[model samples]
Target: MGEPFYITTAISYPNGKPHIGHAYEAIAADVIARFQRAMGRDVRFQTGTDEHGLKMMQKARDLGITPKQLCDGMSSYFIAMCDNLDVSYDVFIRTTEERHHTASQELWRRLEANGDLYLDRYEGWYSVRDEAFYDESELVAGEGGDKLSPQGTPVEWTVEESWFFRLSKYAEPLLKLYAEQPDFIQPDGRRNEVLRFVEGGLRDLSVSRTSFDWGVKVPGSDGHVMYVWVDALTNYITGLGFPDETGDFANYWPANIHLIGKDIVRFHTVYWPAILMSAGLALPRQVFGHGFLLNRGQKESKSLGNVTDPLELAERFGVDPLRYFLMREVAFGQDGSYSPEAIVTRCNAELANSYGNLVQRVLSMIFKNMDGTLETFSSAEADDVLLATVFAACRDELPREFAAMNFSGGIDAWMRGVFACNAYVDEQAPWTLRKTDPDRMRAVLLTLFMAIRDLTIAIAPVVPTSASKVLDQLGIPADERSYAALTGADWYMARVATGEKLGAPVPAFPRLELPEDAA
Candidate 1:
């Protein structure tokens, strides 16, 4: 056990089936959680479907199904997506659950008791597509001269009796929060965007809706359901067993980070923090707004007919390969595009050719040339240098970059270590040395064996399945695969003491071929 670490992905609104964007957020959050665990943190990761809102209600009506039926069916797909993608979430929360309703109502009562809530009327531009309300100033003109939200979603004017939260009162406090804790909202660009939005001034937000009842009911108020954002944001605490304010809630109430898409930054960073403040709860440590995943340079959409099913991609290319490609191709805070060709090329070049081939070759030589035996060997300056390079990448560079959420940059550093190993193998030519100088050949192969273990452990958080296969073949114990084990000087001697020998190796990441029709 280690210090408690809590991370969450934005609850996906399940008005539709899971999309690439949903998979992207879920996978990225899982990577963070896995990485934290590898770094010796006791991590709690939560993700789920936000099943209540006007969108879900209207979508259910259009499909002629009950809202609960729609949520039950649609949320299953998201759960499947997370499972299929190997997202190791600890909790999967559904807002429709009775416990979540209780948690949300208690949060509402706290806000009311703080004198921040009041009955009011809301008449403004709202985007059901975005599940957000916008001021008239935030609207942009569409091609047809219609008003659109900043996200370009169509907005509709609505008037309803509602309950409002005193968001206007939190502007100064929030600005102070941002100024004092610069990392409170991640990616300097997103923080600056929020700074500008808050500087302009905050408005009291409608916290309850009277139009329809597809949300948590406002306590002691009839015909008023808590606003969808209010309910949705509460899911983070609800998963921790809030309102009870004990056990997990007391331990993890202030989430380490809320990993969400950029479109929802205002809600998480602005609205979410204010609500928590009013309730006298600790604010989350950070809110990270990650950029979208695009389909070959264009945003995927139904109208464009370019929507991709992430599971299909995972099936085409192996799951580990797809996972590797995403973290390698995308800069964490910036938009990145992907295609069938991109997936095949990136995975084959990096996972298969670089790291995977390194593992296969090193282990194969140990099985053949070294008689599958383990022994202590002397290392030359070159072997020492190669091991140093790999160790630094695994221990120093990757961990530092990952701590700052720089996935691609960390992978880049790891690749340099891989490149160094390949160059070492080519220079050493252990195959030729096997006939001429058997002892040096044994040393070379064994040195590579050491390097392989470190590399595999460092990357396991990203591609867990394939990494595990390689580790299993290497005879590394399951419990010793974490980053903490990377520096153990006695692990090799301990293994040698066991007289464990290598078996013939299998390719952990076989090369992927693009389908003929994929183009």
Candidate 2:
């Protein structure tokens, strides 16, 4: 409705190779971006790596490489993964990039100018693994009575001279903002958590770290660098051209949505907005903290050796199916498990049996009987009913489902059309009609063709390759392949060129074979 829709996935920490969890988030965000674009909205999708963090520095040290080298190498892998996943991101912003550092420093300067930043001595429990400072109340007793962070990462007491942001001063203002915009932080539970945290009390946030030298250097400060969370959080604005308010920045600022994991809801909902308010900037419209992807029964992590490699999965199973499973298997804002069998089951049931079979059977019937041309289907009553239903699904039902981010529900509605068409073909018995009533057979085949064309367009955002294959089979020209065209009957009248051979139906989703003992 407005100029364009802008969405972003939280820039991932490139401490290690990306796993299925990372791929899941990217695919989810990409689906939303693609759907909005298909609805004729200009869409800007942003995703990238967060390279400046304590964990990243530690990872660089472990790899015996410089931080830049490690980040560059790992960031490349993430970019390749996005490509493999068919994620149409507009820009990839790395925290180590000059643009990002410049933006981060500018944000700091704005906060400093507003008198929100001050030098202070910090003494608290810090976790390098978590890149977070924990209060004593948050630490739990570990084995041998050692204190552990809530994340189960070890913690140690640290004292340093750090710059602190006046987060405590903005607590009341943030609570008021949250009350004014109840939908600002999504999924109710995440919002409640943030509200409760703010209600309890707010503490001054350490914005700079004197210990980490691998981060953005604080403006006018030689020994201190901006903290990783503060640096990484600035990327949303930086990617849009924050400080200068340039054309691109002005065009996409006040991002429509920020898609992040549930683990970091605090930084996004609380700290990030507080920083923005301190700098006299508008907060993003929505911050949706989607849940994690669990492996074996626990959260996926490097130490557990349970992390699923996204590239390997893409290579084994096609990218579309993997992308489809990620969105289809779980509700967008809930934690879900990943098993090879679950992926295979969804592909076989939804893609192969439901969608793919319907298209193949319809096209095969048309090719054999009418030579793939339907001149006058509008006159037939049965044909009109099927066409009406398919159009309703594509034009009304699917769009509503997608608007609510119910991707699986949207695909299910589209699948209902597929199933109904299949049943209609069987009941009409086109093969019998071809001999007894040639005119009836033409109507039936035409109805099937229209249904196939509409369903393919509806599911294109989820499975582009397979949808394109359906378009090729229908002889629909590239120009006619759009949501608007599919919803109207005008596109159906376009003459199908005779003798154009349809491609052989290769299995869109082949069954996955697993060893008996593997599960």
Candidate 3:
């Protein structure tokens, strides 16, 4: 979080409603951006739609609308999903925007001027579903012996005269970039896969297509539109008002990370860097291809009819609970199953029963017994080794996991703190101590208050709205929500707000059983 950190999610191709997979990437990127901001970093987060694609054109034609009209109608759905998730993207760029067209044309000119573009008759197997081309060897055979892309997306033979980018010439350079910056592609598996693909052989890439008019037009080529990848990938720079890198672009260019889906790893890790190299632009620091979200052990897709509407899930359980389950149930960077069973389990057990119950019980006891005013803490009980260990462990582990983009690990680390607090409350029996040793009871409540305070700050990125409520009940000032507030002075008996009256506490996560409201 020291340097300016810029990150992006692959722009959604706005042909339909965004599924859980789309929300997964957005939430992950948002967590990183929010965490970095909390760490006091200058962070720029970008996400949006890749509206200029063959798919969008087809969808538009099927609807009897122009592609622009289709993009306008569909992009709002993606924007709505981001808003519903509380994604704090600084910019939502659409490739159809004029700025993107300018940036794309500039990139094309740079590649052409640098001798990377050559017009040639192209013939190959292409996957419309994937928006990518595949070589004969890269194709998989189906049960019917039909050719398919490696991901099993069906491929069709296509021939067109197109502009080619000299990707073959940059193979060594791209590999060297990977070797020099070992983290160029992340999650080791993706890095290795990209390396193997490049090592197999480098082929010049088709950079422009004449088949459709729905994409950014190649500079000086009236009949050709830039290939979707070429046009779409530039949105990263275009979002910053690229080709003009004077302000936003100058400050945040060469993004810290491009957080893309695993399916698009090759385009981001391979072709993207090659194109940037031809333009003499610095590569993005990292391209992390996180795994897909599987619903019922199968990928969420329209064809499967299992594509989950993110808004539906959010409506069933409050937005924060939905956010928590996704980051908690799924290990970041690996395929994780999402099922109603898993969601309800995490929502009821972790959020409602465990974490929520702890907060409500502790605050209710203080309110009913002590008039909700915090009293002086006495750390006389050395038996609170468990609670002490929790504070130390969370202070050590939470930031480390968060910085590494392991949302699950970060939340797990915080849950260690949560579970310990719950265990401490039971072991100390604050209610029993309230009558016998009132001083001891005060100390115990104070300890619980401090523990909740620290945890609320730690969890703000994941469950912001609930954490804000928790912080308010703890009498935390608006400005002190950052981790800095948790540091300094023995946190066991915080002098920051001694004898402060806490606001009335409400249940954070209520146990869920499907009702009409959930619909």
Candidate that scores best on TM-score: 1
TM-scores, in order shown? 0.99, 0.95, 0.96
Clashing pairs in 3: none
- Order of candidates by TM-score, top first? 1, 3, 2
User: Whole-model lDDT, candidate 1?
Assistant: 0.93
* Model 2 lDDT tens row, 131-154: 888889889998889999987889
Each prediction's Cα RMSD? Answer: 0.8, 2.1, 2.1
The sequence of per-residue lDDT tens digits that candidate 3 reaches over residues 277-317 is: 88988889999999989987898767777878999888877
**Candidate 1 wrong stretches, greater than 4 Å:** none
Give the alpha-carbon lDDT of every model.
0.93, 0.83, 0.86
Best by lDDT: 1
Q: Which 10-residue span in candidate 2 carries the lowest summed lDDT?
A: 496-505
- Displacement of the residue 301 alpha carbon in candidate 2, Å: 3.3
User: If candidate 3 were superposed on the true structure by all CA atoms, what would the RMSD be?
Assistant: 2.1
